[model samples]
Target: LEPLAEAGVDAVVLGCTHYPLLRPVIETVGARMFPSGLTLADGAEATAAELATLLTERELRGAGPGGLEMLVTDLPDRFAEVASRFLGEDVEGLAVKQVDL
Candidate 1:
């Protein structure tokens, strides 16, 4: 953050699955570090927003509740645990299929 501030970077992308959890602290530090204001963007939220916009524009919004299906090539046992952690939601009872390819 100090390096970015020194380099005059005015925007920071919260790019990982866990970075959003620290958004408040990051914003406070950014405000103090970057005197000229700063922009903090959550990458996942931005991507989801863009996807929603595209789906709406293309008239592809589904009429029913969306279903989530997780597929993995290996480690079926750990997939759910890892996915739940990464997604920040309880993915219990969700089928995680193991694929050969």
Candidate 2:
């Protein structure tokens, strides 16, 4: 953070997908928000458009989303109950691993 201030990057992008969830804290620390405000499939479309331009410039474009593979690192006790509501399907017959951490 200090280096960015010294080096003068006027705008910073928190590129992590989940960083948007910390918008409140980021603002409290004096950062700006420029959100596309789209999720999931919509996010994929926006991503594709933005990436297509860059890939065309450098010719690095290739197909994406070979398939979906979800692996969660810490399955909370209530994960089953809450996941179905968010994922829109019952998460039965799926095994979640437990770790001490």
Against the true structure, whose lDDT is highest?
A: 1
Task: Report lDDT (CA) for all predictions.
Answer: 0.86, 0.54
TM-scores of the candidates in the order shown:
0.58, 0.33
Number of the predicted model whose TM-score against the real structure is largest: 1
Candidate 2 residue runs with Cα over 4 Å from true position: 31-69, 72-101
Q: Cα deviation of 58 in candidate 1 (Å)?
A: 2.6
Error of 1 at 9 (Å): 1.8
Worst 10 residues of 1 by lDDT: 74-83
lDDT of 1: 0.86
Q: Write the per-residue lDDT of candidate 2 for residues 15-88, one digit (tens) a residue.
A: 65545555456555544322322122235447879988998899886666654333555564465556666567
Question: Which stretches of model 1 miss by more than 4 angstroms?
Answer: 70-89, 92-101
